[model samples]
Target: MGQQAMDTFRSCIPLFQALSDTARQDIILLLAEHDRLTVNEITEFATLSRPAISHHLKILLENRLVEVEQKGLQRYYSLSLDPAVAQLKALIHTVETTCCKESF
Candidate 1:
């Protein structure tokens, strides 16, 4: 692979790794059902500590899987579909396009 392709693949690694964690996965599922939520609201559904929830949110934020909307003192977390989907689509497109073009 070229430098650009390698760079894109490297960038996507964290996203996949982030989803591999059960705690992070649960947070994503929770966000999917609701429009948005704050840490306090999320804590109501989870057994994790406030700091643990915050930590998972931080990873999800870093992976571009979720976004936060701050309203005054509250920060609402929501799933960010386009970015994660785009990255996945890019990876799929690369494999389908490049791999299929090759001869067996």
Candidate 2:
């Protein structure tokens, strides 16, 4: 890859850069409850304003951390099943498993 493309790819680390801890935890929790959610549902569930949810969704979407689907007039968001998202989850799993080994 070209330097610019490499830089852009590195800049888009959804597992790290796309969200703060609070927002990331919130998104994870919401996904656990429902496989998919509309922006309005997220806003209501998170107790965040609509605009705030929109902004977070934009970042998550750009990073491929979330996927979107259209349902008539509504748009729903869900965890992406793409490679990057999978890798991110795998990384987290590795860390958790390592920690468990150390504790036991």
Candidate 3:
């Protein structure tokens, strides 16, 4: 990959940096299983303190990795199928296909 493409991919991974491993895993699992979540819900499910969840959410939001919607008094968060995710998936596909032609 070119430097710019690689840089973008590297930067995207840092959205999970503020999270503990378990917290990061929980977020991924939640996104896979649910359509959306509130901050309180994520904090409870992830077993992180509310402030920690909020910190991680900030990174996710700033990077456009997650979308936020305000409904009345609550803010809901959901995974965003943005260009970064698409590009990362495409890159993974290329690597897997080229490196493991028979299996992947």
Best by lDDT: 1
TM-scores for the candidates: 0.88, 0.64, 0.65
Candidate 2 segments whose C-alpha is farther than 4 A from its true place: 1-15, 86-104
Q: Write the per-residue lDDT of candidate 3 for residues 1-104, one digit (tens) a residue.
A: 55655655565465445333566557757976889999998877876788988877786676666788999999999987575467567667655655454774
Ranking by lDDT: 1, 2, 3
- Candidate 3: which stretches are off by over 4 Å? 1-22, 89-104
Clashing pairs in 1: none
Error of 3 at 31 (Å): 2.1
lDDT by residue (25-94, candidate 2, tens digit) is: 5875786679899988888888778988888888778777778899999999998747565666555555
Candidate 1's error at 3, in angstroms?
Answer: 4.3
| lDDT measured at residue 97 in model 1 versus the true structure, 0 to 100 | 58
RMSD of 3: 4.0
Put down candidate 1 lDDT per residue, 9-87, tens digits, no spaces. Answer: 7878998899899999999999999999999999999999999999999999988899999999999999997898999
Q: Pairing residues by index, what is the TM-score of model 2?
A: 0.64
Cα error, candidate 3, residue 60 (Å): 1.2
Top candidate by TM-score: 1
Which is the winner by TM-score between candidate 1 and candidate 3? 1
